[model samples]
Target: MTIVDVPGSKSITARALFLAAAAEGTTTLVRPLLSDDTEGFAEGLLALGYRVERRPDRWLVQGSPTGPAAREARVYCRDGATTARFLPALAAAGRGDFRFDASAQMRRRPVAPLTRALRGLGVEVRHLEAEGHHPLGITADGIEGGELTLDAGESSQYLTALLMLGPLTRQGLRITVTRLVSAPYVEITLAMMRAFGVEVERRDSPEGEVFDVPPGGYRATTYAIEPDASTASYFFAAAALMGHEVTVAGLGRGALQGDLRFVEVLERMGARVRVTDEATTVAGTGTLDGLTVNMRDVSDTMPTLAALAPFASGPVRIEDVANTRVKECDRLEACAENLRRMGVPVRTGPDWIEIDPAAPGPAEIATHGDHRMVMSFAVASLRTPGVTFDDPGCVRKTFPGFHEAFAALREQWQGLAARR
Candidate 1:
């Protein structure tokens, strides 16, 4: 198989769309990723009355994220949490009525901190179903932002959501975080929002339990989406466990995604790491040295790290990842269960997990519809005997080329077991 270079992931796609829509003028996104979740986000903007057209390979977005100036519309966010979570605050800034709703799975994802923060911004939010969550009936006439207290235990997205919309209100917002984890995502939020048009001042407590986002709307501009480092973790694991070297390209030197730290994890675990402006290369050294790491910030990359753990020499322990529960699935538990089925020693708690290396066994991994779970463990099949993942198609939520890319890389691993 030839080395195939895939586009970025839907996480980058959705954020780019928000940034583009927030900016004025005809913004063209080149070589952009197209998928269910990103497509849903684009359509949500259309529902809010933005003119977005998708050509064969590029998206032509024409709108002034001043967002809906002439009218008000109600948007149902479906299962796109990026849309459901971020757009509400955007609507509040644009001074439009945005009724946010999601599918059963997305509805189950927590949105309380975001909603509470919006209310504190003086944007009235009504929960159509569960209290403090989504399918929210957002009636916005713009925010009279002042001070907001946010509980971001569920996810950092909540705080990021507030920061993105804070700049649009009359009194700019000051967000005080109650209990915040996954702080890197907030950094991502600030980076994107700043690119789009908003300026924010952030202050964090020692443990990251508290944060502040100074009130200001995002500034709009031509922003580029980097290749997803989180998505690249799977392929990195494949290269480190199997006999091949896999390189994922298109990320920049100063790329803002937090999951870019995956390289650090691989380097520490004894893989030879090579860096470039557009790509990352990881190769296995055959022998491994496991290490214990705190993943409170890079929790999303932990799944892929765990996938590679079974190939290590010592025990690998990951702690401070309670936020994994609010993601597309309960990532920590799912990773542990799948690893155990492969005969790896595993232990898990609410906020931590441990895995020991062994001769990996064969098992059918249940992905529980989480894309990361499917992609991470699929690479684990390289060193392990094998794994058949349920709902393998779940990878479409973030990466459509995952299985194909994983397969192509494995072709170089001289004695790789056959993929089903």
Candidate 2:
């Protein structure tokens, strides 16, 4: 079995930074992800006058229970949605005149639901450029958090931001989420909050799910991040597509990430999967079966499945992933377009995509500057030679050395095949 070590979780790293910044005392984060999105989050913290020490293997963040140190600052959020949404909420819990902006791509993405929720909680939030979008301003004395309803249908980051902000509020927060997508991420948030010394009470209400976060902020501690299950999806897909036995270390049945459940999909598609406390393995059985799947919760792995679908014996249909449209790009169309470029038959709707079985040919993948697009098609290229990306380096958003790492794995697999 080929053992692959993926980078630390981006979601965990981002949340860790937020939690550490909001907690009392210093926080040591071991194996934090170092990439454009995560780095941008750390930099935003610095811009807000939070102390962050970056090391080769870990990160040190000084917490301030009251919030950002800077009274006035302009935080450029880069392309990270966490940085864009979470930082504003973090700033709102402090005394500051903070203006936030982002890249053009990020600027197009909506932050309205989050901003509106913040406004309802008695925080002064202004849309500087477009309503409910980034390029916004917050004049905050502090939050007096109370009951509020939210719609997190387009993105879960809105709910995550509010959930993280709960402790910093005056009266604490009673959040009633009217609609939520990607529920597993909320579980990660709650688990991490418990680690940092706060417990959020969750229960079902008539309206929706209710989360009760009490007053008194978090206490800092040492945290170890897990390997990114989303990033590992590419490698897992590679194994299933190429009929290799691949094991990803640091991810087991107990992994906090819901994306790790992508293996179950592979298992259903004829791969032999083994899950244990230490790691998870996927050994392709030289057969791939395709079926319809709803990917609303683990939607991040949708692209990886799309790239692997053409090799399956039947059509692969992915549904309930409409939130993916508002991500770095419209992922459904992007996947459909790229598969078509490979000369595969594909169909798409508002919330689903279907790929008919065919041998994909070489094509230039248009990445739209979205990192997942480049990485997904790179997996497709393992089978279809001469496949190239219009913007290969866009993967710097999550994995800076994805091409190099994937190439190494390809070489290793080839050598194993040769020996066999």
Candidate 3:
């Protein structure tokens, strides 16, 4: 079996940075993800006057319960949605006049739900440009938090931002989420918060899911980040499509990422999947059975599945991923457009896409500057020669060495085939 070492999770690293900054002592994050998005998060923390010492594999963040040391700061969030959404809430809990902006792509994404919740909790939020979009300013005098309601159907980051901000408030926070998508991500947030010393009370009420966070703040600790399961999906897809055995290190049945469930989709498609306490492995069975799937919780793998659907024996239908449209790009349309370019039959609606089985042809995939787009289409390149990406380097958003790693794997698989 080909064992691959995937990078640390972007989600976990971002949440850890927030937790470490809010805790009472210095936090050491072991194996934190190093990428444009994550580095941007550390830099945003520095801009807010939080001390962050970065090394190759670990990050040290000094916590300040009172809030940012810089009374005035300007943070460019780059293309990371977590940095854009979570940092503003982090700044709001401190005493500061912080201005936040993002890349043009991130600026187009909405953040009104988060801002609205912050306003309800009495934080000063100003939309410098379009309403509900970034390029916003937070004039903070510290949060005296109480009860508030929010709609988090568009993105779960809104809820995560508020959840992380809960302990920093004077009265703590009681959040009632009216609508929530990507529920598993919220679970990750709760678990990480518990690890850092705070426990949030969650219950399903008649109104919605209520989270009661107490005011006592967090205590810093050493946290080891798990390897990214979303990044592993690409290599797993590669093994399935090419009939090879691949094992991803640092992920198992007990892994926190909901994206790890992508192997279940592969299992349903006739691949053999083995899960242990320490790792998970996928082996191809030389047969791919297409089926319908709902990927609301693990929607980040939608593009990976879309890229492999053409090789299946029947139509592959993906459903309940409407929120994907508002991601880095319109993912549904991007997948359909690229598949059509490869001369594959595909159809899409507001939230679903169906792909008919075919031998996908050569085409130049439009990356749209989204990292997932580049990584997903790279899997399709395995069987279809001449398949290329318009912007292969865009994978730097999450995995800077993705191309090199994937290429080495291809060489190993080829050598194994030659021996066989």
Native-to-model Cα distance after best TM-score fit, residue 92 in candidate 1, in Å: 2.1
Report lDDT (Cα) of residue 311, candidate 1. 81
Give lDDT tens digits, candidate 3, residues 1-420.
999999999999999999999999999999999999999999999999999999988999999988888999999999999999999999998997999999999999999999999998888999999999999999999999999999999999999999999999999999999999999899999999999899999999998999999888999999999999999999999989999999987899789999999999999999999999999999998889999999999999999999999999999999999999999999999999999999999999999999999999999999899999989988999899999999998899999999999999989988988999
TM-score per candidate, chains pooled:
0.90, 0.99, 0.99
Q: After superposition, how far is residue 63 of candidate 1 from its true place, in Å?
A: 3.0
The lowest-lDDT stretch of 10 consecutive residues in candidate 2 is 151-160
RMSD of each: 3.2, 0.7, 0.7
What is the lDDT for 250 in model 1?
76
Give residue 288's lDDT in candidate 1 (0 to 100). Answer: 70
lDDT of each: 0.74, 0.94, 0.95
Instruction: Tell me the TM-score of model 2.
Output: 0.99
Instruction: Report the CA-based lDDT of candidate 2 relative to the real structure.
Output: 0.94
Error of 3 at 277 (Å): 0.6
The clash tally of candidate 2 reads: 0
Q: Largest lDDT belongs to which candidate?
A: 3
